[model samples]
Target chain A: MSALLYLVTHKLKNRVREIFHRPSELVLLLIGAALVVFVVFTGNLDVDPGAVRPRAELSAIIFALYALVFVLTAKNGFVNGASMFSMADVNLLFTGPNKEKTLLSYGLFSQMGRSLMLGLFILYQYSWVHRAYGVTLTDLVILLVGYGMTAFLGQMLAMLLYSFTSGSDSRVRLAKGVFYGVIGAFVLYFAFLVLRAPEGELLPKVLAAAASPVLHFFPVAGFVRLGTVGAMELHASHIAIGLGCFAGCLILYYILISVLDMDFYEDVLKATEVSFSAITARKEGKAQEQAPRNVKVGKTGLGKGFGASVIAQKHRVENRRGKVLLLDLTSVVMAVVTVAFAFFTKQPVGALVMSMYLMIMTIGTGRWAKELLLPYVYLIPEPPFRKLLYMLREQLPALLMQSAVTFIPLYFLLHCDPLTVAAFILARTSAGWLFIGVDLLLHRWFGAGSNKALLLMFYFLFCSLSCVPGAAFAVVLFQILFIPLSVSVLAMAALNLLLALLLLFLSRNVLSASESNNQ
Target chain B: MLQVNHVTKKYGKLTANRDVSFQIGDGEIAVLLGPNGAGKSTIIKCIAGLLRFEGEILLDGFVNKTLDAKKRLGYVPEMPAIYDMLTVGEHLEFMLRAYKMEDDGTADRLLERFELLDKKNKLGKELSKGMQQKLSLCCALVHRPSVIIFDEPMVGLDPHAIKQLKEVFLELRQSGASVLISTHMIDSVEAYWDKAYIMKDGAFVAERSASDTTEASLEDLFFALTEGGADA
Candidate 1:
């Protein structure tokens, strides 16, 4: 236990020292802290003060989110178990002279820290939450505590379930059956409530169902939700019952582990290995996460191209496997969600903006980025500029397809002219190119010395800076030239495309200059 | 043929390879023997045109980064980096196509030689580490490169595959291709290397040839150079 404490303290001390050692990372951290402070104090992300949402509505949303996270976490744990331990922990602590109970406590302690960190994401929404719910500091802290507890409880339950059912097929089956049955019952109960209501508006009935005391009796999510809602509404009994239930669950888990003397090393090993590999793959910018377990080697060859063009062919083949059309599952989902959002809010352009933002956020995870990390892209016998163009070939088509799928429906929804539709599609697809350009430019500048936090800060900064020229052009065309909005949009799109091309040409040397430490 | 003229590479202030000059002529097999952090991989990467360096590297009398040179050069990285989505067979085909080589069953033959023919249809992710290394080797070889480089190639290879790789090196040299192998596993390359360079502190401390090392084995020479002080 003392060793574990020493390890934790040293790890924390070193992590702080590491941040300070990397000046750029330290600067980024400071900037992040400044931004958080500004946002929290401002009580708004933007000029418009957030509209106060109903407390029941907020409660319902949080409850739904908590429930979804719990279910997914449990399902994953059922198969692979929950891993609070990393590969290093497995290698060092698991093999060291430490009691199992102490090690378990250390794992849970680390897990609690992670849960707290995860809960901090909600702090970024401080402005909106405070404005919308009239939340005080104490209320916010209570909610944060509730959220962290919910996360911790979910993992604890997952660990217990895994330990109980591991290595026994019948036990797993029975556990899963019980799990599904409980979930089914809750859904049925909610549906029954909604159906039996006096049927004026659907939302009130749903919120009423969410606020029902019956939900507070179910499990961890409910208990946490009750505590949070109770805190928000200042209900003492609700808080006690809700928080007491969570504490009871934790005590139960501790007793089970201590009494059963469960050997969970094997169970967590698989999850830890999976997590380590996945993290490594992400760090190396490998898009291997999308790969299905069972790949059908339908075709055995690239089937086309020589030299640099084979890269495009390789990407095409990989994309084909992941998608039926040019649009993959994610694209389809984005399109559907965008259309639904537009239909509900009657804000086609707003939905288009949201979808484009989604695309921009995800551009770094594409195959082109992965290509740069691997050796073949540099080893291929071609001019750097030409190789880059070929590398981007597959991305362009997919971006176009995604934009078309996302925005074409908006033509009808917006009741807009064809030119307007074209302009929106062009702008959206062009943003992908611009973001890709920014990614390449950053890589070209930083090369192998790129730090994630530093690069992320620069990535956003560069992206925003890169958009200025096109935006200025659009503004001039629209405000000065008296051009229609669609025409201005088209002009902006053209400028963005040209800028992306220029960036591509400038960043071509990234292919030649970039080095992988893996070598 | 490959020529590395006074090449130097640095990562920030740390010099990974300092004024490293070496050459491997056609039909020759040269091994770079170095301890960890001895700059073997750095020099290999510089020669492969994957890193920016101060000096010149020429393959077949062309700049290493040029199309002509790249076409003739093959590099197997120290860690096998195979595409998770691409099948083992597809990997070779992609390499062949990338190198503008005719698909003349070289892929299959190489797979057979590496004992990867049965798992040719397996996705790269499905193969074990040793198998992935085998696939990486097959990709590098399918192009029939005139100059081939391997960095720690035997790290994950099975005994049979290692033996097969040594044979392949001889075959490649017989075919008049230059082979440069970077490995700390001195015994693996002792039997066939025409020349060996022992590197320390980012520079070659000693060079030995097969004909010159009659009095002392490569193992003894390496220990004398690398571990002599620690031993004393």
Candidate 2:
């Protein structure tokens, strides 16, 4: 038993050392530490007025951030580009003289170091704040213990969620639906809070009642219960219950590890395979069935004609052409989802624009630019203008499809004027297209994946500048000069388009010249 | 026809290919013999238009850097140039799309010829190195371009696969494709190639026609050229 314990600790230490060596891990640790410090210092320094109780709101915010971190770290759980506990690794381990339980213990303990670090940091900061707020030493200790328990519970829950969703297409779909539904419900609740403060007052009671089981059993709830006890100066019963919750969480964690199976690793691998298979199936089916096979050859049999031979030569080259409808369909579906989410959530138009920007930046820009721009400029045999014309023709269907999705949803859901909706969609789509063009040009000039940070910075800047207040101020400035706000918007759109075109020209010329010089 | 004119490539201060020049006519099989890091692959890549070089290369009289020039060129890199996520069939389909080829049975026929038809649905990562090399050759040949450039094409092949590949090269040459193969497999390619260029220190040290070196053998000629015994 002592040897087994030693093996587990050694493995855990090695895992921690490996994680610390990674650049991303270092960055995350620093960010986590800074965030903890900020929350603690702010919570302690800024005392809210008329607050007879400690701020549960601030604790909820911190916990939410911790949950986000938990999700991200769990998703990126691979070590050195390999899964920590893959089926193949398990099989290899089984072949060795080491016992299965020992290997299992090592795997389980490997994940504990990072969780322990995050838990200790949160607990330490919260304890500092609690002590400063005149909490008793016993209560502070209980809160710290509760925080550690909560962090462990969060990691376990994340892993369990991953395990449950693995290799189950229907379960994944259901999980996504439930997740979206919960987010929608939260948005609705926030909207109610904003619009009807009196009704919002009833939310805490509802939440407290809903949180009863959590208060009794959940580790995070134990921390919250401790906070409530400290603030209200409650009896010893509450403190006892909080301690009981922490103990229960520890027991549950051990039980979970004991029951874990090889199926969990197999399921994760299968999930990846299934997802890729689905994509491949869809692409193959569509391309094979729908795409046209032939184009009419020019009748004037310039059979040996230079242009004809060029055309013949091009025809001989294997071109992977699919129907433009696939991309159009994707754009339409994405736009519809964005508009629906925005309208139902009652987000301002600016928020809708920002969401559209993010969508286009990630999905549309990367893919469309890779497919349309790179191929035309660098791969295909055509004049630059002709290539540009081909790109416009190819992308028109997708543009119209996205426009219809955006306009129809906004008109119906927001009760906006048809013309206004049209203008809005046009403006947003134009901006998106311009952004895609710019991204393509940047990618070509700087090399792919190089300007990701720069693009992100630009996105944030664009979002800030395109807010309602900024737009309104611009409109007022234009009106003072007796110019129409519509004209200014058009001018802004044109400017963006011009900038995109300029970048395109510069990239094309530079790449072409470089290629020529290399030759 | 493919021609490399005083071509040189450098990565930082280390020269990969220096003032290397060679030519392969239609229906000719020209092998580039070199040790590792001797710039044979660099010359092949430059000819294939996959890399930028200091000098000039021409594919059938057109400059090598153009997409039009590349359209007539087929390349098989030393490492299997295949998407791991894509199956053999999907890879074939993607090649067909890139080359703008109609959905003919050309890819299927190539697979059948290479005995890879049964494994066409398997992902490239699932295949053995020999099978992967065969798949790479199939993708390269599926388009039937006029010029073919291969870099270390026999590195990971079984003896049988290597023999089969030699037969494929003969077949491709018969079909009028100019072939330039870079490989360390001098002994195997000895009887197959019409002409050979032995490179050392980023330059071609010897060029010998099959007719001229009937008794000497390619391995002897290769060692002679790279061992600094030949005077350019």
Fnat for each predicted structure, in order: 0.80, 0.04
Candidate 1's residue-wise lDDT over B19-132, tens digit each? 888888899999999789999988998888888889999998999988888889889988787887788889988887777778798889999999999997888888999999
Superposed on all Cα atoms, the candidates' RMSDs to the truth, in angstroms, are 4.1, 10.2
What is the C-alpha local distance difference test score of candidate 1?
0.81
DockQ of each: 0.69, 0.21
DockQ of 1: 0.69
**What tens digits encode model 1's per-residue C-alpha lDDT throughout A14-126?**
99998899887799889888877887778843433345556776787668757756776666657667888989999999898888888888898999899877776566667
Give the count of colliding residue pairs in each prediction: 0, 12
Pick by lDDT: which candidate is best? 1
Q: Model 2 over residues A305-345: C-alpha lDDT tens digits?
A: 12112322222221222233424444654564566445433
Which is the leading candidate under TM-score? 1
Model 1: clashing residue pairs? Answer: none
Per-residue lDDT tens digits for candidate 2, residues B1-232, read 9888999887556788889888889999999888777878767756765455699999988997676785787878666655444467766665665556665799899888778999976755567878888898887877778998887888888777777888989988998889998888777787779988888888877888888844566787677667756554
